[model samples]
Target: MAITSIFNDAFVLTWDFILTIVDAVTPSHPAGHVVPAGHPGAGGEWPEYVSPGEGDSRCACPMLNAMANHGILPHDGKNISFKTMNETIRSTYNFSPSFCYFVPNYIARALDKDYFKDTFDLEQISVRNDKGIEHDASLTREDVRFQPDQGKPHIPFINELLATASGKDTSAEDPENALMLTSDDLARYSAKRRTDLENIGGKLDFIHKMFGSSNSATLLRIVGGHVSDLRPFLIDERIPDKWEPAIRSRVGLTMARFNLTVLPLEFSTRKHMKALAKAKKSG
Candidate 1:
């Protein structure tokens, strides 16, 4: 009974689940703010044997993926606990350009939500201070954050994109199956990317703009910009033909970030219908 709602629906959500999802979906990093609840400080890695540092037990840490993989209650109605699932998250993830933090939230939701018997109302989610500025100075420290040995200046970008980009920190022993998911599997996973973008488009758009500035452009140039894999629909062709060169200047973002746009109209409409039917029956 797999469940997926590209929108942020709040009906089936429990208090704990809703609180967690709220923090996960509305990333505070955009506001350059780090509240007591969560913060992405650095991209540190453990060699897997050195006394199994805090990373070993951090399934519920702020990064939505880690929290999803580590913190959420298992939906299988079994005794699956964070102690049991931490190893899986360490091994199930990988790093990539389009590998935004949103994927883990999707996987985590799947694990927590009762997909078969439950439905969510996507319109209920809300955001604050959505003026579209990336990395709100109010939330960030002007002081430098620690960076990995990887020689990149954008600590958060590197920590996020390069550090746990794969979402997993450990590698599978089975080389054949280690990160061996097919494009089909990736596409299925990739859908989460779109769902996440949709969930917090306002914040993400601002972050995308921040990265394009001269100071940060080089950082994004590597993984094709922060929001590199958007669909053609996301492309803003209206920039004056003259500024086109400036606005559409980067390499990775110059092309459509994604291969396609939203889920097919038919499927989306059908999902909505199914949701309505379920809602009516419940009412």
Candidate 2:
């Protein structure tokens, strides 16, 4: 069934977001027919012969099904389930839930690569095949952008920022004008990082610094894409008492969805350390 997207807002929608929404809203049949799982109708299970670029090859379709099953996407509208979607993701990616959950992220990345083709010449980018040697690959305009050098500055970084702000002749890298910080300043900064790592509130603040406010759209999209799987935390009673307030506060974000999406690895590391210590004591 052809699905029309209602996401026409100013928010930048990633390709995965579009696909997932489309899958969720689209009826199984044009005639609104619902087929059994193994039936040979439009609502039947996904076909077995799906090629890499067509039909079930796209990750978001299965994710949409998962969302529907978990009540994240309304089952009445699309009627797919998280279990069904999870099966498809596992079959396609051959990965565990932790890995398969990132399918939307992979899709977003691929779309980003294709989107960048318009800004940079993909023909200039060299890619290596299975042999580990670089080759031109004879890319077409329709090909995903393979420009590895795109991260390089077109001009000096400071100069570009200066041009945008004002035509200032000042350069930040100049040692003569550099302001030196004391040892106490460095120690205070290190102490603050340690303090942030010790609690959920500080960790959230750190996450905000990394990807929040104006730049939180991408992380939010990832969280939103997997809302069915992530939303359990909003209601789960097992979450640490100290972290409850912080998690609950951000549940209603329009574009800054899940806190876990931007959570630092150090948080997980701390948990691991605690577990290890507990095991050592018990053993």
Top model number, lDDT: 2
Candidate 2 wrongly placed segments (more than 4 Å): 1-44, 49-112, 116-255, 258-269, 277-283
Model 1 per-residue lDDT tens digits across residues 87-107: 332232211112222332433
lDDT of 1: 0.25
Error of 1 at 172 (Å): 10
Candidate 2 lDDT? 0.27
Lowest summed lDDT window (length 10), candidate 1: 237-246
Clashes of 2: 4
| Cα lDDT computed for each candidate against the true fold | 0.25, 0.27
| Candidate 2: worst-modelled 10 consecutive residues by lDDT | 135-144
